[model samples]
Target: MSNATNPTAEDAPPTTDEESVSVGTWLTVFGGVLGAFIAVLNIHITNASLKDIQGALSATLEEGSFISTAYLTAEVVIIPVTGWLAMVFGLRPYMLFNTVVFALTTLLCASAWSLESMLVFRTLAGLAGGTLIPLSFMLILTLLPPSKQAIGMGMFALTATQAPSIGPTLGGYLTEAFGWQSVFYLQIVPTGIMFLILFQGLKKTKPQLELLKNGDWFGILSMAVGLGAMIIVLEEGNRKDWLESDFILNGTLLAVTCLITFVVIELKRKDPFINLRLLARRNFLLSNLVGIILGLGLYGSVFIMPMFLAQIHGFNAMQIGLVMMWIGLPQLIVVPIVLRLMPHIDIRILLAFGAFIFGLSCLLNIHMTADYGHDHLIWPNIIRGLGMPFIMVPLNVIATAGLDKEDVGSASGLFNVLRNLGGAVGIAVLATFLSLRQQYHSSHIVENVSAYNPFTMERLQGFANHFGNLGADPILAQEQALRAIDAIARRESFIMAYNDCFYFMGAAFIVSLGFIALMKKPG
Candidate 1:
């Protein structure tokens, strides 16, 4: 009963002959990609709105953080399974159902009366929405001929990369103007249109019910438990102080046990949920390694830049978006150029240059200071924009290009999962580094600011005099002056810590260059 043998018609992709490429094909791609776009975009659109959501629901900030965490947890867990789930449900019905569900969840999230309800809706949104990214990636393979794939992937990357860049800006404006509910509302129209377009042609893609009986339920359970537990740990680890906390300790143990169990179960299972067989291939393995690093850079920076802008630069979400746009818009020119070069050049060279450029850009930010703002970010971010497509498009092409048609689903799913997981891990690392480094920096700076030093004495006296002149009591003046100097020192320490983080982040990009080197260009 395992799908390893006796492949069914349902295992094959639905195809139209060369003679009659119908409008339905276009509509199908359009529907699927648009759904994918909105789904990916949703990951971040609600990002800038979380504070408002917390205020509206009267939930503590910790509870509000789960809105994104739950969504991402569901998303990462569901991504690898989507390929098989789609085939089991029939791609058309599966796609259509998820689109409707995702759209509905947006409405529910918008209307949620409490944090608990919002978490449920957001998780559902992730469950239904995460499938679209890898689903659409494989669909492009099925729907388009080899010649058109680069272009299809180009557009997909553009949407995936561009949407998150501006998500905060869009969320900011909507939350500022109409309230946080508007962020959820923002995607409804796009999702609705996606559903309507797919509703017509998707029925033609038949379901394979036999897959239901042969399904790897054990594998599924293991994956869900493993990934869900792991993501929760990563997302909350810093806040909970890592393995020291009971919650984090248990989560870590569960994650390790389940993931190890999942891998063993998968290796031995005859039609595994995720198709571990693909990882044996050299190109696929190398490409996925690159994917993880790229995700760390892309998602990690996306997380950090906004924190830098909103927390330090005093920018609103919209203003942060304005700067983030520099990282995305250049892709418009870069993608087309990368596509053109793919046939003529070796992909490894492109990847090396791209990775090097991105890493160098990270190094450039090591110069960040309290005064750095939009003007300081422009060229480095643009360089990052140009570097991204070269790395992503080539890596994606290399990953799936060598894969067999049937393997594309599993490979795509795995590729996306690693990338999403990378993002989560990257953010956790960034957050932890900032928190610990901030403390270390503050303490180290304070150690040198003692009034025993001439500079310290002068600075301390100046603050006390300024406060005394402003009508503070003598005792209160000294206290206020001390607090004021401490605040300045703390800010300076934070800036330096961020500078340190950039150097660490840049190291990730440099490491990726080795993976790119190891990937053999598909002959």
Candidate 2:
């Protein structure tokens, strides 16, 4: 079946036993999946500990934010290029080197004395760790035959669906019990185990150094600059007031120009480093489209929940983590069932069903009240847990179904890139929206609660009398009454705004069903 006329196929590794893949191949895939899980887990691990880290480093909230931003920006920039680099250096040595770098950088992040030092170390770590995600994806598709792909997809699901859900939980617990630094140091044992497993499992292949000369250097530069700038704009844009701030304005312009240049370069080049043409395939493109919404809901929900608990219910990190576990833990049981169901199911139906349930979970949160607490959140989180595996596992199979071996690397890179991009965009939109809605709700409440309203006056006088009963001076009690009213208004406004955010995410997920309709059923 080997075709000498097809250079791409010729370059592909020799076909292995399709019916019975070796144990080593499974082990290699396991290592890759584990690496991907670690990479993704790191993204959210710092979230629960950001305040502690900020205090320790003597950094402001805005300055501390860069710790996450640095990692995300570098990760987004490096992902698309990973496939090409792996090809050039050979996957074994390339992955091992990056793993080592990732391990070292983990230590560096732990030992960082200042925000600047942390950002540098984080960026380096992101560059190294980013490779794991796409490479793991490429490994599953290239190594496993169709029959076993469901199992592979199930394992990969843990990384995509489970990792984000579990990250805050783990980090919160660790920070509470051990300290903020433990979150970084936590990776050490896993990294070592991962290194050893990968070392043994992966068969060595010669580096295709000749491929370097043909590398799409211009495209690479454009993509890196473009993606990096885009991430910065999204992460910092709201806080910096979008295009109003000079930094955000300039970053937006740079991102636009560079990304446009990248697209033009990619489309024109015959042997582009990463194949942009794979998007022309219907299933691949549609799967990616749905994936954007997936990321939006996934990351956006995770970001919003902790803030919701902290602001409304006054939950600490550990308490928030405990509640969040409803979203994370059930997947262990659910994904196996999903894997079993995959054979008999039409994956398109499964994917759509998953999307629907996930959206339903968000919609369930739309009625959140000031009193909404841990018990009220459980069903929605568990529903989300069920829905995620259905979405993630099927979507992976659909996207990669008809792809050729040579194209898997590029496809993997593009697939991962879009999901991360979606996450960035989602976080930005939700953050901005939350602020705007809060203002809107607060203004409406303020306008309605005027002296002209008897009910408002009654409530105000009641509060004043209550404070006066606590032995405050008459004037002081009146002032305290006004402050209390304002606080109530503010709290209620925030609750409404948060409800709006949940509704927005739910609508996004439901709307994504249209894209799923466009996808061809997996063969």
Candidate 3:
């Protein structure tokens, strides 16, 4: 028999027989990856249109904030449990049911009449859609052997790296061209296609109903509550002033208590809900650690870059989207090239190189001025785009190398959960850092600007004369000039704060290189 059927062949790669990986299997894997893409897409897509949606619903900024917050909390809570649920229900049926629920809930979001209604529908949508991510990851490990897993990893990378990048761009364009409701409506076509692909591509299998009898129900409950509360604390902490707010303080304690309990329970269980033991493997543990840095860089940059453009340059949603496309679009070309190179180079080396390049991209923005705008960001964003594909595919490969099929689900869940948790933490930390830094810079600059200083007096006169030429009375022109100087100082402080945020991210990436050093070559 040929090597295809000969498991004993010494030269054959140590995985499932590649020849048995049928076209239908490929379709199912890619289709599920697409589902994951849509799931992540929904997280950021609404952000661009949030203000418009708030206006339509007549909600204050704080109340309207729950719209995204609810979805994120629900999504993070569901990710860890997805793998075990898929096994119990059977992957095909479990996936199809969630897809339909995701589609229907998203549609309901378009019709929400108030902030309360939107939060309910968004949380439901998140619960249903969140299953797609880990399930797609599990399918990849189970269905493909080592030889072809790179292609599958490339597709999955798009969900992790590209979806967030494209989300605001797509959301902004849809809301501008069609309306804020169209952001919800945008899900219809993609979900329809995903449902059809999943239905046709997936092969039916009997549910393992007996596994339910042995399920770690206590572990599941603790994990759900703990992760949910943790997500809320991360996403809302900065806004609520962290421990200063009773709500945030309580949530933090609850998260710490429950997550610790969950870990203890899993450590002692015979078949844990998620096998935390996977972290004992050096490469798997190191990769997940690196995954945190990747998430921080990916989601943190996406969060900050758009805010900078909007706050500083006063760019509209469409203009911000146009600028972000540079980061999102170049990966399409880079992925194929990275895949080609993976066979020749050491995966660890490639990953480190990617991290190095990504660090450089962040550092490139550390010297921003008030004049920095669209043109200044393109190369850095493009460099970011290049670096991501290198890290994503190789990182996934190294993490899963030599993992058993039985353990794939737990590993996938842990890997995805940590990365997402990192993202939530990154955004909160970056926002807080920016705010505090801006205040520091603003105060320092203001201390130097006194009415007693001659240069300050001269600059005030220049502003006053300019406003006086615009027909303001002398007293009013002088007041306007003072305000203008303050505004300029505030603007300069903001630019410095933005530079500090970028510097922090770059330094974090460089620090992550130490963790990458611990991982072995992919088997």
TM-score for each model: 0.95, 0.97, 0.96
**Per-residue accuracy of model 1 over 1-523 as CA lDDT, tens digit each:** 1233211123233555633445666667767778778887897889888888899999887788888889999999999888888777677778778888998998999999988999999999999999888877876777766766777788777767887777877888898899989999889999988878877656555667877887888888989999999999999999889988999999999999999999998899877877887888988888888888888889888888888877777898888888988998899999999999988999789878888988998899988988899999988899889898888888778888855666667887899999888888888999999988889989999899986889988988898999999999889999998898888898888888888778877999899888887887786
Off by over 4 Å in 2: 1-15
Model 3, global lDDT: 0.87
Q: Which ten residues in a row have the lowest lDDT in candidate 1?
A: 1-10
True lDDT of residue 217, candidate 3: 91
How do these models rank on lDDT, best leading? Answer: 2, 3, 1
**What RMSD value applies to candidate 1?**
2.3
Best TM-score among the predictions, by candidate number: 2
Residues 391-503, candidate 3: write the lDDT tens digits: 89999999999987667778888999899988989999999999999999999999999999899999999999999999999999999999999999999999999999999
Error of 3 at 203 (Å): 1.5
List runs of model 3 lying over 4 Å from the truth: 1-20
Better of 2 and 3 by lDDT: 2
RMSD of each: 2.3, 2.5, 4.3
- Residues 77-170 of candidate 2 have per-residue lDDT tens digits of 9999888888777888888999999999988999998888999999999999999999888778777788888899889888987778878889
lDDT, candidate 2, residue 291? 88
* Lowest summed lDDT window (length 10), candidate 2: 1-10
* Candidate lDDT values, in order: 0.83, 0.88, 0.87
User: What's the ranking of the predictions by TM-score, best on top?
Assistant: 2, 3, 1
Q: Could you tell me the TM-score of candidate 2?
A: 0.97
